[model samples]
Target: MDLQKQLNEDMKQAMKNREKQRLVVIRSVKSALQNEQINKGSDLTEEEVLTVLNREMKQRKESLHEFENANRDDLVAKVEAEMDVLHTYLPEQLSDEELQKIVDETIAETGASSKAEMGKVMGAIMPKVKGKADGGQVNRLVLQSLS
Candidate 1:
């Protein structure tokens, strides 16, 4: 099913099951997607939907980190739960090995021989790995490859 349809179905299920945390996370994601649609004045394609999901996940991860640093176990648990809910929608993440392989191929293809060409390498790689790999991990691998 398309993500929007699946989200609607899950939202109904969450309501019926009284899964409060799941419901809240789903509603927030739906709200974010709706806001993006309004800003663009168009319905989102699947790729755009994934972009929104990734953005939400990134936000959750950042919050999770901050909560951990602040020693707020309660907030950390809540953000972790939200991250778990968001993970259900994202495509399976790339393994480090798989991402490294792709980075190597992209560097070779783009003739990016040094760190100075990192931008060129990243521009070519992001679309291929979008929604599957974390940007920081990709950046680390590219830097490792270049140096």
Candidate 2:
């Protein structure tokens, strides 16, 4: 099933199963997708939907970190659960070796020979890595290879 239909089915299942937290996260995801569609005045592609899911997952991870620092186990658990739900919609994550290989190829493709050309390399890499790899790790590996 496409993501929108899959999300709708999951939302219905969550409601019927009385999964309050799961239902809430699914609803928030639907709302974000709807807002994006309306803003752009078109239906979202699978890749576009994945972008929204990744953004939500990233936000929850950041929240989870703050909750951990505050020793709020309750909130931490909730955010983690939300992140778990979000993960179901993202593309399979890239392994470090796989990511490093892609970064190296992009560096060569962009003719980026040093740290000074990091912007060119990054611009070329982000499109390929979007929703599949973490930006920070990508940046770090790019710097390591360049340096």
Worst 10 residues of 1 by lDDT: 60-69
- Across 1-147, the per-residue lDDT of candidate 2 in tens digits comes to 999999999999999999998999999999999999999899999989988888888889889999999999999988988888888888899999999999999998999998999999999999999989999999999999999
User: Who wins the lDDT comparison?
Assistant: 1
Give me the candidate number with maximum TM-score.
1
Instruction: List TM-scores for all candidates, in order.
Output: 0.99, 0.96
Regions of candidate 1 where Cα sits further than 4 Å from its true position: none
Please list all clashing residue pairs in model 1, or write none if there are none: none
Alpha carbon deviation, residue 119, candidate 1 (Å): 0.3
Report the lDDT tens digits of candidate 1 across residue range 95-147. 99999999999999999999999999999999999999999999999999999
lDDT agreement of model 2 with the native: 0.93
Give candidate 1's error at residue 130 in angstroms: 0.4
Which residue pairs show backbone clashes in model 2? none
